[model samples]
Target chain A: MFEGYTLAELGSIFAMQGFAGLILFSVFVLMALGLAIIFGQMGVINMAHGEFMILGAYITYFTSNFFLNYLPALFSVYFFVAMILAFVGAGALGMLVEWGMIRHLYRRPLDTLLATWGLSLMLQQFYRSVFGAREVGVELPQWLIGSLPVTDVIEVPINGLFVMALTLLITVAVAVLMYRSRWGKQVRAVMQNRVMAGAVGIDTEKVDRYTFGIGCGIAGVAGSAFTMVGSTGPTSGQLYIVDTFLVVVFGGAQSLLGTIASAFVISQAQSTMEFFLSGSMAKVLTLLAVVGILMLRPQGLFVLKVRR
Target chain B: MRSGNIFLKRNEVVFVVILSALLLVVFPMALDSFRLNLVGKYLTYAFVALGLVLCWGNAGILSLGQGIFFGLGGYGMAMFLKLEASSPEHTAIQSTPGIPDFMDWNQITELPAFWLPFHSLTLTIVAILVVPAVFAWIIGVAMFKRRVGGVYFAIITQAIAAILTILIVGQQGYTGGINGITDLRTLKGWDIRTDFAKEVLYFVNVALLLGCLLLAQFVRRSKYGRILVAIRDKEDRVRFSGYDVSNFKIFIFCFASVLAAIGGAMFTLQVGFMSPSFVGIVPSIEMVIYCAVGGRLSLFGAVYGTLFVNYAKTIFSESFPELWLFAMGALFIGVVMAFPNGLAGLWQAYAQPWFDRIGQRGAPRPISPAPISPTAAPAERRT
Candidate 1:
């Protein structure tokens, strides 16, 4: 595949593709982080995770328009505000879903997949009906626009850099929130043994509702970041669901570090291969490799050794 | 009066009689050919739903990628039909006279090596059945032997569906891409496009469905069936009791794939085309919903559920296209949350007790032959 390129050209090519892969990896981490939390921690399959992310995207879209219309002077800074609102909006909805739907399905993990799938469909239709079916892209502020020319062959887009920074910041925050905080401990305790946690006077239901909400909030933030790189459509969420699920599952559902690692590996492989193979073929090969590996290690890349 | 073999209980005999009459006699006499054909299309999905009843509901293997098998079977049949339809004389104007139109359009002068076996009808039929079974067996062994199941199995199967769809749609030159295999004219020179042929095909579809239904019923009744139920509830216990639990799961998964393939082949014959659209995640999940709505545990309910949901989809999508998805979505949530067992469960819970009471009143003796346990009685009466 590298037969025709000079060493310098190949170096630049890898550099450029690797940067592109980082943007994709950022999005995957954002999506898969929330999923790993819900699925790994709670043992619930949220098939509507993608839709929750889209809710964040739509929230960002509206925030941008709102800023452009009502607060013209602050239009450039609307993204931060949009991200916050997206988190709240998606988080609230996620809590509502947990309370209304997911709580009833704690015993039946498989049915949650179906129910959430139905939720995803309804959410897609809701997006289509409200936002129209055409793909929507948020306007970028002047600072976030344009690219930096690192070399004659390698140019890095500013928005991609911003999204990557945002991903890193959020990932660190989530890691801290999951690992160090008192609430995090309570949540982990609930997940480890619900009855024992309740016996210790921890309110398991409240922890569940909040955990689901926070996961969804992070997905919302991810969706907000997604607008920086690509167009969002009503059906865009469905496209990412399988890939994100693969990332989480491949990373060992219980480990936060595993999710990030799997996402990086998958996105890098896919984008680098895209430079050589057709885009769909690259995706096929990447997913096939992941699935093959998963077959061998069904517990995923990392396993949490916990007694039943 | 209990039958000696226990193949069909007293009420089960009546249920079978009524269901057969409805499919074979009432439907044909009542509906026009187009409507009947639509029902036939719905019935094709019933094969998939029936398979789900056994695989998912009984054995607790919920494969979201049944569409892969369906597509394999449909495409297998479609390849044969396409080759027959694209005979050299019919495509004399094209650059490649003997190849499928899509291939000729893509500048290929010859058929691919994989397309060679599909040239013969017998080979096509065999491929349709065996390919999906082999594929399912591979997936089942790889996953089940590792004890990877539940949501994990469902997700993996869904990923497989996504992969297959991408492969089919991506390889347009060989697989007909997104437009899929179309313009299928005849099957062994029978002119399948004709009205008479369509009517015959509907009958053929019904016969195949009925045959599959009986086979599924047999599996559900056999000792293996009880073991499957046992495995579903407590797989480790079954394994510790000296059963190769994975083998039972693999067998049922393979069995389900074969049933789905049969439906796919019949769908190609009746619908006259095959596409990646039906082989994707969305359609595969929708097929599960059909099984769910009908009552996953009940074979007859699966058939009825397929018909009911498809019928509503057609009617609702045609009239209020926007609302169809909402209705379908509600159906999924409603079916799962409110009534996990589905329409049959509703019937059993609400209606059967009333019928039993009326029957008891009609009988002079207070059910003296056998004191029916309320819990076990309804289940046995249905099948």
Candidate 2:
């Protein structure tokens, strides 16, 4: 496939595709990060994770509209406000769903998947009703609007860079929150031994709710970041759900670092393949590889060295 | 489960008789050919749902990729119908005269090697069965042999469905692309589009479904079915008892795949086309939900679940399109959370006892076991 390209063209191709891959990597990382928490840690499959992300997208969409209409002066910084609002909105909804739906099905993880799927359908219909069925995009602030010319043929979009940077910061924050913070410790403790954690003075129920909330909150942020790259639609989130689940599961579901690593590998492979083959073919191949690898290594790329 | 007199205990025989009558006579007599054809279309899904009862409800193996087999069988049948429809006289305008129109539209002058075997009707039918069985066998062996049960197996199967859909849609020239093998006109000179033909086809679909129901009932009643329930509830216990657990899982999964394949093939015949839309994660999971709604444990319930849910879907999407998802989503959550046993469970708990009371005066009713969470020690196993 590369045989037709000149040396300079090949360099530019790899560089450009690699950059594109990096943006994809960021999206996968963010989506898989939230999924790893709820699904991997809690043992609850939230099939509606994608819809929760779309909720964040809608929140971002509405925030942009509010800032545009009512606070034009602050519109340049609206994304920051929108990100926070997306977090709160998505997190609150997450907590409510966890309380109303997920909590009952904790003993049945597969049932949680089905129920959340139902929630996802309702959310999608709600989005369709509220936002209209068409995909919508947010107006980028001036600072995030353009691209940086790296070379004559290799240019990187500034919004792509911004999303990647945001992903990095959030990834670090999540790592710190998961590994370094007290709440993270409590969440981990509960995940390891729910009864023991409760016995040790952890509010396991509250932890479960918060953990689910925060995980969904991150998906909101992912959706917010997504508005920069692609238009948001009622069905947009669903397109990524299977891929994101694959990323989390193939990463060895319980490990955050594994999620990151799996996302990077998949995104890079997919993007590079996109340049060589058609986009759908690339997706098929990448997913086939992931499924194939999973068959061989069902625990995935990483394991926590723990017994169930 | 009782170890003797396994064809059907008294109640099951009554259930089968009632179901067969409804499927064979009641539905046909109640509606026009068009509605009957639609019911036939829905019955195809019942095939998938019935298989789900054994695999997911009975054996605790939840496959989210039943669509793959369904689509494979549909596509295989569609391919043969397509070739027959795309005769040299019919497709004379295309660059390629003898091939299906989609291939010609994509500028392929010759048939793909893989699609050649499908030109034969006998081969296509065999492919419809064998292909999915082989595919399911491989997948079931890989995942179950590795002890990858639960959500992991579900996700992997879903990924396979996604991959297959992408492949089907991407390679449009070969697999008819996303629009699918459309404009299927006949089945080897038999005009399938006519109302009389449709009525005949409806009976064929019902016959196959009843046959499948009987087979599923036999399995459910057998000692093998007992082992499946045992595996579902206490997999480790069954493993320690020296039965090859993976083999059982693989066999059952293959059986489910074959059933789904038949459904898919029937679906194509009834609906006139098959597309990648039915071969994705969404449709696959929706099929599971159909079984879940029907009473995942009840084969009789599986048919009604497919009929009523699809009937609702057809009606709702026609009237209030937006509310359909809400209804569907609620069904999923409600089924899993509130009524895991579905309509069958409801029938057993409330309706059956009431009917029995009406049937006999002052007779002591058989006490039905209350519903228990699948995780809890089984207060009532279905037998």
Candidate 3:
């Protein structure tokens, strides 16, 4: 189909597709990081992880509305504040869930899956009742609303760039918190061996709560960022959950680095295929590829060296 | 003396058979059609729960894609019903010719080739069992052979169900998208709208439920059931002892899929419609909860769990629809925390003591501790 295209045209198309893949990768990483921590660290399958992201998106929506309606002059800078508020809102809900429901079901991982799933459905319906089932369009600041021109033929979406920057910052912050901070050390200890960590006087319960909160908070950030690229509806989270899980599982659930790499691979594959085929066909092909790969390497692309 | 013991066993079966007959024969007469239909739906759920008990409780595979199987069976029946309803011979005088209304809206000139076989009842029934079995077999071979178990397996199965639902919804022409297959009428020459047909369907569902329960019981008491439980508790040990663990997993997984398919078929028959909503990630998870809350280790748990959850769903939706999910969430949390064995576990824990004291003469044999913790044991097994 593109046999007659010039070299420069092909290069531009490739660059644009690459850029789209990077944007998608960032989103996937942001969403899956939280899930990986909850699932890999605590061994609790929080099926409501997507719902938590939706909670964040909803927070961003309301925050933007507040800025627009009550403080019109500050609208230009509302994105930063909205993102923070989203983090807190989603983080707080995560904490509440941990305290109220998840903490009790730690021993029964499978049961937690069902409980969180029910929680997701309930939250989705609640959002529908409160916000209406129609997709809500969040008003982005003028600075983040459009594309940035890279060349005569190639323009990169500012929102995509913004998401990439945000993902980078969050990734660095999480890396520092996990490796350099006391709480991170404690979380690692708990994840590695809870009994030993508890014996060593680490308050494992507190670490669990904070770890879960941070994971949820990151998911919220992802959701806030998603508003730029996708519609926000009561059930919008469902669209991302499968891909998010795919990224986490295929990347190897134990390592953040694996998540990033897997996200890059899957998103690039998907974006490239999407360029050549219909959207649904691209998704099916990507899923089939992931399933095929996972069948070969059940522990995913990376396996942490830990005793089973 | 062995013959006497056998007679006592047969007596227990006889009692159960008599009780089921009484319930099936009398319950519909006593209740309104709506309630009767509700009970019939519960029976269908019970069958699905039985499949869970086998796959999850016994085989130690936490399948989250049974909803897909259930959906396949449902759509299969729905296809036949839609065909039968839309046939020129049975079409209402006011109804449009050929295409169903949804198809007309979607501008479908002809039915898809895959849907052609659903015009026959026998084909539909065969497809219900075969479709899910084939799907499960392929997935099982890929996953179980690769040694994916525990959380990874659960997530993958869930992803399959989620993706399947999305695919179904996206295919607006054949699957009716999100709105699903609705406005279903007569079933195989029977007027579904009439109370007589509803009563007959109810009886059919009841018979199917009883038959399924018996089948599950038989499976559980067989040597194969013991091997399944052993596989759940210790896969490597069984493999080392010369058993092909993968084959066992595949067998049980296929069996569960068939059972789920049957349940799905019956459920659609009673409900008179099918939709993408009926089989999705959420419903799949709900099926697991039904098994969990009933106590996966117990046969009665499956039956009771489905009944209890479905009943709660009906009551809560009517009374406080908004709070229903929250309530269910709370219930799940509470059950996992306080009642690990589920409502059935609670019943057995408290009520079994009394029953044991009244019926047994000697002291109960000491229960041997299994090699792994019951809850954790299932996940440890590879195959």
Candidate 4:
């Protein structure tokens, strides 16, 4: 495949596609973080997780439109406001779903998958009806658009770089919140042993709800960042849901670090193969490899040293 | 336990008879050929639903990838039909006169080795059943042997479905692409497109469905069925009691896949085309909803469930396309939340009591092991 290209050209090609994979990695990590927390901790398969992300995407859309229409001078910084609103909007909805449907089906993990699938269908239809079926692309701020040329052959898109930086910031914040914060300890305590956490005077149920909200909130931020590179549609979320789930499952569902690592591995492999093969074939091979590995190591890439 | 273990007690026989009458006599007499063909297609899904009744409802193995097997069988039949339709005489104008048109378009001058066996009717029939069975066996062995069950199994199977769909859609030349294996003209020189052939195919579909229903009944009523239920309820206990839990799980999953495959094959014969649309994640999950709506426990209810949901889908999606998603979404939520046991559960609760009170007081209780609620987790609960 590389026979035609000079060594320098091949190097640049790898670098460019490798960067593309990093952007995909950021998306996967952002999408799977919430899912890993909800699925691993609660053992509830939230099939509507993608829908929740789409909710964030839609919020970002309206925020951008508002800024474009009413605040022309402030358009450059509108994404910051959109990110906050998307987080709050998606988080609030996640909490409501947790309180309503998911709260009822915790015991049956399988049933949760079905119910949330129902939830996903309703949400998708709602989006389709509210927003026309056509995919809507966000108009990027001038500062966020364009590309930086590292060399004559290798150019990197500014929006991709921005999304990557944003992913790094959020991932670090999530890591710190999960590991170093007092509340994070409480959440972990509850996940580790509900009865013990309750016995210790921790409000376990409240912790559970908040943990779910935070997970979903992260997904919303992911979607906010996604507006930079991809167009949003009612069903775009469905396109990534399977891939996101694979990242979470293959990474070791409960391990945040595992999720990131797996996402990086999968995204990189997919992008590299996609350069050589047709996009669909590349995706099939990537997923097939993941599934094959998962069957062999059902516990996933990282198994937390928990007694259970 | 033995006394309660019989297959289709007296009144249950009457139930099956009436159901058969509806499919065999009443539907044919009333509906036109086109509508009857549509019904026949829906009945194919009933094969899948009945398999779910045994595997999912009875044994507690929820596979989200039934569509893989369904597609495998569908493509198997489709391959044969495409070959027969693309004979040298019919395709004399093309560069590759004998091979499928898709292959010719893809610039392949020769037929692939894999498509050769599809030329024989016997081989096609064998492939229809064995292809899915073999694939299911592989998945079943790999997952079950490792004690992978529940949500993990479902997700893995779902991934397989996605991979297969992508493969089919991507490798257009080999598998007929997104349009799928189309322009299917005949089956063993009989014009399947004709109305008379359509009626004949519908009867064959119904007969195969009933045969599958009986096979499922046999599995449900035998000792293996009891073991399967035990494994579902108390898997560890069953393992401790010296039964091979994985073997039972594998068997049921493979059995379900085979049933789904047979449905897929019949669907190709009746519908005259096989497409990737039917074998993807969306359609696969939709198939599960069919089983869910029919009361996952009752075989007879499964058939009705498949027909009712598809019929509503056709009508609503055709008339008010937008409302169909909402309606379908509501159906999934409603089936899971309000009636986990489905239509059969409703019948067992309200209608059956009235029947029992009116006349069945002196008769033996007519019930299957499934319709009655089991000591399992209720579908919904609040902490």
Candidate 5:
């Protein structure tokens, strides 16, 4: 397949696809982080996680429009503001869902999957009604556009770089918050033993609500980042839901670091294969590989041994 | 005393009779040919629901990839139909004279290796039944043997569905791609597009569905069925009690997949075509909702639930398209949250008691003498 391409051209092509894969990796990491927290820590399969991210995407779209019309001078900086709003908007809705639906379903994890799937459907319809059926893309500021010429053959898109940077920042923030913060400790405690955590006066319910909220907040931020690389639609979230779930499940649901690593591996494999195969074929192959590996190692890439 | 029929209780026999009457006589007599054909299409989905009733509700394995089996079966039948439809004279205008139109469109002159066996009707029928069962067995063995159940199993099955959809859509030459295998005209020289053919197919579909329903009912009544329920509730206990839990799960999963595949083949025969749209995540999950709404545990309820939900969907989507989704979403939430048992549970709880009172005045009690002890009776016969 590479018989005609020069060695340098092949090198640059690999470099280009690798960078593209990094962008996908960034998106995967952002989406899977939220899922790991909810599915891993809480044992709640929020099928609506993608919808929540789409909600953030829609929120960002609205924010960008608002900034463009009312505060054009501050438009370049609007992304940061939009990201924050997306987080809060998605987080509040997440908490609301948790209180209303998920709390009752913690005992029946499978039922939670079904119920949230219903929630996702409603949310998709809600987005369609509000935003129209067509996809909406956010306009990037002058600063986030264009490409940086790393070499004659390898030019990296600035938006891709910015999204990667944002992903790294958010991943670090989530890691620190999950490990170093007092709330993170409580969340982990509640996850480990609800009865014991409650007996120790840890406010397990509060932790659960907040944990769910934070996870959703991250999904919203993912949606915000997603607007950089691609357009957003009501059903676009559905496209990512299965892939994001696989990433989390493949990473070993409980491990945040594992999520990042698995996301990188999957995204790279997919992006690199896309160059050689049709897009659908690449996706089919990637997913087939993931499912096969999962069948062999159901605990995923990273295992945190704990007694059931 | 035990019932005259070993498989069915007395009330169940009546239930079966009424259901058969509804499908076989009442529907055919009442509805127009087009509408009857539409009902036949919906009944194909009931095969999936019936399968779910056993594997998911009874055995406690929720496979979100039933669409794969359905699509496989549909495509298997479709291959044969497409081959027949694409006889050399039918496509003399195309670059390729004897191959499927899609294959000619893709510039392929010869048939693919896999498409060869589908040329023979016997092999096609055999393939439709055996292929899905093999696929399901592979998945069941891979997951159940590894002790992967609940959400992981659901996610993996869903992923498989997604993969199959992508594969089908990607290999357009082989699988007919996203548009799917269409323009299917006949089944063994019978013009299936005709009204008369549709009516015949509808009866055939109903007959097959009743057969599957009875088969499912027998499985639910057997000792294996009891063990399946036990595995659902306390898998480890069943495992410790010298039962091979994985094998039980594999059997039910394979059973469900075959049921779904049978539905799929019938669907192709009735609908005149099959598409990837029906082989994807959305359709697969919607099939689950059909089973859920019917009362996942009740086989008869699954059939009714499928009919009812599909009816509502058609009516709602036609009249108020936007509201259809909201209604479906609410149905899922309501069924899961408020009434976990679905329509059957509602009937059993509220309506059956009243009917039983009327029946008791006119006839003797319907249930057999408590064979396993009165206290264990409720648990034993929950399905």
Candidate 6:
């Protein structure tokens, strides 16, 4: 169809595709980070992680509504406040679940999968009951609702840029938290050797709670950010959970770098395929590729050095 | 001692005979049409649960993707039924010709190449079993051989289910998309709407369930079952003991896939429809929960678990629809935390005292504790 396209046109098409990929990669990273922490670090098969993100998206929706009605002048700043609130909201719920249910079943990872899965279904239904089943459009703030012109022939959406930046910022912050902070060290210690960490006076329970909260909080952030690009509904989280898990598993459970790399690879593949084919086919192809790759390297792209 | 042995033998023989009689004769008369249909569905789920017992419960491998196999079998059957319904003779009588409604809507002129073989019942049945087995065998060999275990294995399996669902849903022209293959017509000229057909399907499902359960029982008592259990408990230890752990896992996984396929086939037969929703990650997770709640260690537990939980779902959905999910969540949490042994475990525990009391002096006691197998830890943990 494009056989007669000039080199310049082809170059522009490639550039646009890369830009689209970068936006998708950011979303993928945001989605996977929370899951990696929950499943990879804590060994809790948190089927409710996606629901936590939806909670954030709903919080963002409410914040936008409040801003439009009561504080129209501060609409642009609503996202920041909403993001913080979402983090707290989802984090609090995560802590409650941890203390109430997940904490009791740590030894039984498989059981935890079912428990969390049931929790997810309940949450989804609860959202449906409260918000109605239809998708809710969160009005984008005026300042963030346009495109940024990269060239005469090519343009990128400002929201995509925001997501990319936010993803990078979050990734860097998470890296710092994991590597530089004492709490991060404790989390790693607990993950590596829980009994040894406890012997050294690390509060493994507290670590578990905090780690879970952080993971859920990130999910909330991802959800809130997703309001810019996707539909917000009762079951919206279901759409991303599989993709998020794919990234986490394909990346290698314990490696953040692997998550980032896999996100880039998967998103790029998905975006490029999407440009050529339809959306659903692209997803299928990407999944098939992931399954094919995982078949080759069952441990994933990056293997953790921790002894089982 | 002789009397005791005789009593034990009598109890085992009588138990089977009574159960068979109940299944063959009593159940049909005791239950109403709706209840019979519900039981039939449960029996189908029991088949899936039995497969899970082999893969997750017995093999120590938590396969979160049995739904894929189940869905493949389901879609396979649905495809055949759809083809049968769309035969040239039936199409001439109907308003639309050749293609199904969705295909007509989507402007598909010809049947997809892959779906052509489904017109033959023999080919369809073969495909139903072979497709899932082939898929599982390939995936299982890749994963088990590569030494993937624990959460990693679970996640990958789940990914497979998710990906498969998406693929099926995306191919709107061929696979009926997200709406799934629904509103199926008569199966092999049997009127699906008639009570007689439903009854026939119920009996067929019961037979399949009993046959599969017996086969599972045999497998469980076999040496391969012993090795599978060993691999589950300690793969490294088993490997050092000169056993091929991966091969055992693959074998059980393939077996489980076939069982899931049979369940799927029966499910499609009873329901007379199939959809992508039936084969996704959520349903796959539900399969695991079924085994967990029923008592993953016991074959009877798998059957019991499917019946009890699905019955609970029906009751809750009808009575307190809004709170159904909440109730399910609470039940799952409660079961995992308190009654980890599940309903089967509870039955065994409660039955033991009664069995002991009924036993006379010098009479052999039934319900002897079987030797603990390695893969039986999950079941034992529940107890």
Instruction: Give the clash count for each candidate.
Output: 0, 1, 0, 0, 0, 5
Task: Find the number of clashing residue pairs for candidate 3.
Answer: 0
Look at candidate 2 and tell me the lDDT of residue B372. Answer: 38
Q: Which residue pairs come into collision in candidate 1?
A: none
**What DockQ does candidate 3 have relative to the true complex?**
0.40
- Candidate 6 matches the true fold with a TM-score of 0.92
lDDT of 5: 0.92
Can you write out model 2's per-residue Cα lDDT over B28-87, one digit (the tens) per residue? 889988899999999999999989999999898889999999999999999999999988
User: What TM-score does chain B alone reach in each candidate, compared with the true chain B?
Assistant: 0.95, 0.94, 0.88, 0.94, 0.95, 0.90
Report the lDDT of model 1 for residue B310.
Answer: 99
Model 4, residue A193: C-alpha shift (Å): 1.6
**3 against 5, candidate with superior TM-score:** 5
Interface RMSD of 2: 2.9
Residue-wise lDDT of candidate 5 within B1-383, one digit each (tens)?
A: 36657888667788899999999999999999989999999999999999999988898888899999999999999999999999999999998798999998988879999999998999999999999999999999999999999889999999999999999999999889999999999889999999999999999999999999999988988899989989988888899999999999999999999999999999999999999999999999999999999887889889999999999999998899999888999998988888777888877777777776777676665753323311122322221
Give candidate 2's error at residue B207 in angstroms: 0.6
TM-score of each: 0.97, 0.97, 0.88, 0.96, 0.97, 0.92
Q: What is the C-alpha lDDT profile of model 6 across A1-308, one tens digit per residue?
A: 46878999878887898899998788789888888888888888888888999999999999999999999999988999999999999999999999988988888787787788888888998998999899997898887889988899899999988988899999998889988999999999999999999999999999999999999999999998888888799988887777888888889878999999999999999987787788888888898899889889877899878775
DockQ of each: 0.57, 0.68, 0.40, 0.62, 0.64, 0.57
For candidate 5, the docking band is medium
Give TM-score values for chain A, per-prediction: 0.99, 0.99, 0.96, 0.98, 0.99, 0.96
True lDDT of residue A256, candidate 6: 91
Mind giving the per-residue lDDT tens digits that candidate 3 earns over A10-101? Answer: 88988898899888888898898888888777887887888888888888888889999999999998878988988898899999989988
lDDT preference between candidates 2 and 4, better one: 2
The sequence of per-residue lDDT tens digits that candidate 3 reaches over residues B1-383 is 26543322443455456648655777776889988888888778777788888888888788988898889888888888887777655444423556555666787777678879988888888898799899899989998887777678888887788778877887777888888887778777777867777788888877777777777767766778778888877788898999988888888888888888888888888888889886887788788888888888756667778888988999999998877877787776666666767765676567645755654545376433321223232232332
lDDT tens per residue, model 6, B164-184: 888878888788999888777
In model 4, where do residues sit more than 4 Å from their true spots? B1-5, B361-383
| Stretches of candidate 5 exceeding 4 Å from the true structure | B364-383
Better of 4 and 5 by DockQ: 5
Poorest 10 consecutive residues of model 1 chain A by lDDT?
A104-113
Give the residue spans of candidate 3 off by over 4 A: A1-21, A69-73, A125-135, A180-182, A198-202, A272-278, B1-22, B88-111, B182-188, B355-383
